[model samples]
Target: MSRRLKNNMLTTIAYVVVLLWLFPMLYMFLSSFKFESQVAVPSLTFTPTLENYRAVVTPEFFKHLNNSVLVTAGTVAVSAILGVLGAYALVYSSLKKANNIYFWFITTIFLPAVAVITPVYIVLAKLHLLDTKLALILLNTGAGIPLMIWMCTTYFKEIPGEIVEAAKIDGCSKAGTFFKIMLPLIKNGIISSALLVFIVTWNEFFFAVTATATQSATLPVYMSKFMTQQGYFWGKMSAAGTMVVIIPILIGFFTYKSLVRGLTAGSVKG
Candidate 1:
């Protein structure tokens, strides 16, 4: 095939992939405006209404939304701070076994939540932290920290060590070098990591279901409530799901450039 034809083919393939990815989300968004009967049928020709959204957004839903927002925000903040510091230390600290430490962080990422749920439940029970937003925040922060370190380390590594040396020679204290110089340079990476952490924590189902009764249940748990013994409330579920999805979508949309830059930072040198 000619190069022009190949380029057109590739572009078409990309569009097809994007359409495939977006179709489900589009369907779900549309379904949220549908009535319960209409949702079961799944026909395009129907009058859209806000009834499902109205039913979905009760006081309980707001409570769950508050819980989700708090947990996501807290997890992102805590993880970012700890992860950035840890990544910086791993890259620049003069430790003999830095590789071992990094390996430990990476290993924790592979550790399944199910495996540790029992011990986690017991610990939380003992501390009387069950059914609390703080518990979810703490759990999510721990889960996020490993991922943050893994990602931020790449951004930190991309920075030249000579920059640090120069900062030091210019009488910049270690703390000043880290906060004033290094942090700004890797701000995009930090934003990317925080956004990822936000999405994960927001959509976290298992822990939210297990740890929270009602007081601290997040949106995922709230969305799960639509599955009743009578039947699935598809309309309300879709509405709740749309709400759960849209926040992250808006956040990602706003940070698209930063996210792309951060993700591709270490891909090329010079």
Candidate 2:
């Protein structure tokens, strides 16, 4: 094919791919404001309403929102803090023995969460933490750490050892090297990881479903059960889903520009 034709073809394909991926989300958005009869009508001629969104903003709705915020914040905070420190240790420490001994920490990611849930549940139950905010936070943190470490490590590794050496020559202690010299250097990684981890924990369903009771139910679990209780109340369910979806997307939009810049924050700084 000619270059012009190929370019046109690629553009068309890109449009199709984007539309294909976005089709469901589009439907979900549209359905959020639809009445039950209009929800699956397969036509766009009908008028939309705000009833669903109004219902989604109720006290019950805020309950789920609060649950989501708690879990997401807890997960992101724990993961970012631990991930930063762990990556710092990996980047700076000379304890080869420690490396081998804790290589298993990274391997925890490969294990399916389902594989560990039974024991985790037993332990949490024994501790009376089942269905509590703490259980979700700790579990989400555990799942988030490996990926957080991997992302943070890449950014930390790119930092120059000379900077760390200079800090030492300046009579800086280990604490200073990390908090003063290194942490700022990897702030982008922290931002990237924090945003990404918050998104993940916000959407996480597995443990949120299994471990949390109604008292701590997240948006996903709330939406999942909302449909059943609604008895084919498609509009309300879709509205709830849209609420859950839109908040994170807005969060991303507000932060992603900063996140991209942050990811490369200190690469060339003196």
Off by over 4 Å in 1: 268-270
Q: Write the per-residue lDDT of candidate 2 for residues 83-134, one digit (tens) a residue.
A: 8888777767886865663467678878888999999999999999988989
| Per-residue accuracy of model 1 over 1-270 as CA lDDT, tens digit each | 899999999999999999999998888899999998899786899999999999999999888888889888899999999999899999898978999999999999899899999999999999999999899988998899999999998888888889999999999999999989999999888898888888888889999999989799999999999999999999899999998898999999999999988877845641
TM-score of 1: 0.96
Q: Could you tell me the lDDT of residue 198 within candidate 2?
A: 83
Q: Rate the local accuracy (lDDT) of all candidates.
A: 0.90, 0.83
Residue 155 lDDT (model 2): 78
TM-score, one value per model: 0.96, 0.87
Query: Which candidate has the highest lDDT of all?
Result: 1
